[model samples]
Target: MKLKNQHIEEFLQSGLLDRYVIGDTSDTENTMVEDMINQHSEVQLAYDKLQEELFLYANTNAITPPDYLKEQVLNKVTPRKELEPEYSKHENWLSIAAVIVALLALSGLGYLYQQNTGLKQEIVETTTQFENLERDYELNDTQKRILEMRLAFIEAGDTEKYLMRGYIEEEPLRVIAYYNQPAGKAQIEIAALPELEKGLDYQLWADVDGEMVSLAVLNDLKPKTISAEILKKASDLNITIEKAGGSKHASVENLVSSIPLNTIP
Candidate 1:
């Protein structure tokens, strides 16, 4: 009932109307075409036009047998002494007209099927495109927020940048921290940290006057914010490999990276 112009055009061009008018369609096709004709005004109009054309063609090409041929048919029937009657020219013409109408109906039905199929495909494609666009928008929004936060950190005054690397040459770990001592604000970027084995976690600690205090545990790549209380009297920031869920006391023997904070201006 609700059809697009382009879809209607496609249906009309598919030549199904011609097939139906000529009685060359299946039962299923007949049902579909009938439904379309009932629901879609465009389809019904097209079907009407096609039938008119076929009728005109049939009339223009109709042939009338001569009188001699009719006599010969009647004579043959009489000689056989059979009571079977000979068919009249008008009767033959009627049969031809009926066949033409059946074909037209079949063709129309086929066209309807094609039109319905096309619409279904269009709907699926449209839905997929919408989903893709939505996903892209969300990703862009998240990136925009991150960029804004990074810019704010850079513009803030009295902020110190600290790059914390691995203690050993073979340990490929790099973490960046921006600390605003005056404002008691801090953010950490875990840029490059190798995946730890199962049942182990990377834990951060603040070394305050030779005593280590747990800061936060690293389990994901998301940005981490250090609490102001942990940075208040911290002299150094340290990372250590600890068991799953981290430890209350720092594992001194598992220290991986440490950066002295006393040099901050």
Candidate 2:
């Protein structure tokens, strides 16, 4: 009973309404027709108009055609020749033009796709090159820092020294002290240093005459010269391995090297 636009068009074209209007219907059929009419106002209107036209044609009995007139009409009706469908020259040309246009469009799209792919690859390569350059720059910066630290150590003037006694399972201590007098700075550069355990750091101490002074903390054992201002006048130097950042007093037992400034040039 429910119909869409397509269903309505199909029913109209099939002439089903003419058959239904002329037939006697049961209660179920009457109910179905009523439901359809209620659901679609357009369908109800079309059905009413068709019924009116059929009723008028069926009831008009006085204006009948004569037998001779009917015969003459039947004689005048002739069979029509079927037309054979053929494509024109212009139609053939148009079809070829359409195919050519489609092929050109597809070729253009493919070219654009390849160009885009190439551009993306180029961008990726360029980005990788930039990353490599950045890594190189970082390495160079680290090297520059190390060189600057070395230069600062060599330029120190004020000097101090302390004695670091060796502990059990470790070798005897040996280290030299150098100070920059003008800058009131001191550095403890170690030689013949022992290998340090992991997570431990070497700490320098300045022995000013007899008093002990913390100088610098060192993690690298690459013959580095640590530079820092002397807190007091000193006479001896000491080098001890302790926890990172060093301690208030030397982990005396972990001493790696110790020497007096009087022995150095």
Candidate 3:
């Protein structure tokens, strides 16, 4: 199994298992974890143990003190004979100590409550920040990869580059394309685009002779590396506004721009 004792320890210590129990994991991960529990005896045992601990914690009674705690409290509250010993000379002192302990316990509980609330808020803020950082990192990494591919395509010395105009011009589109038909690769650099309305997106089409073939429908039009196969049979490239995903046929009336692919530079 990929999971081991260290994994269990981490889950137990880092509170991941608590998140899992509460359905905080993503759907993909939740499904995978359930599968592991079903497939692996070790995983099942660990998971069961966690569940049992939670069940005991939730159902345990509040009024009854444990024997050690009961003994400690009784020691403080019990009245001793006055002439017994110097140790037993505490008449009002034990009572005072008991009250002080109770007050301190209550104060500690309040302090802990405030601390827990503060920690929860910090956790939420940290989670959101982490998600944003992760997204930015992914976008930057993807852009870097696209740029590298574009450079390689250019260096290969066989390309048909086009300006495509209109800030890439697909009716709310923005892309700078490096198309290499021989290598079957297309690299696009996205600059800017008008914000798309809900349920609408920009689509790219390859115009082959007279037929328009659906190439790609872009919603998150990040710099992309696309297959050049679509361009191989294409004599022209066209961009248009389309429904969110794509259409079987091109929306020519909605065409924002067209670039001839084979024009000699």
Best candidate per TM-score, number?
Answer: 1
TM-score, every prediction: 0.56, 0.43, 0.47
Error of 2 at 192 (Å): 6.5
Comparison by TM-score, 1 against 3, better one: 1
lDDT of 1 by residue, 1-265 (tens): 2457777777678876666656565657666666767777989999889778888865554444457755654553332323233333323333454554544454555567678899999999999999999999999999999889777885787777888888434667888878887887888888878788899888999988889898788877778888766777888899999999999999989998888885544
Q: Model 3: how large is the Cα RMSD against the reference?
A: 25.1
Candidate 3 deviant stretches above 4 angstroms: 1-146, 154-156, 167-174, 195-199, 263-265
Clashing pairs in 3: none
Which should have the higher lDDT, number 2 or number 3?
3
Query: Candidate 3 residues 125-183, lDDT tens each?
Result: 99999999999999999989967866777667777566565543345445567777656
- Model 2 residue 156 lDDT score: 43
lDDT values of the candidates? 0.74, 0.58, 0.67
- Cα lDDT of model 2 by residue, 1-265, tens digit: 5548777777556655554454334446545655666677766887789667754643442234457755644443322234232323323333333333344455566668779999999999999999999999999999999779766656544333433455425654455554555565555555545556777777887776676677777655455444444433555567677887788877767655566655332
The local lDDT score (0 to 100) that residue 41 gets in candidate 3 is 76
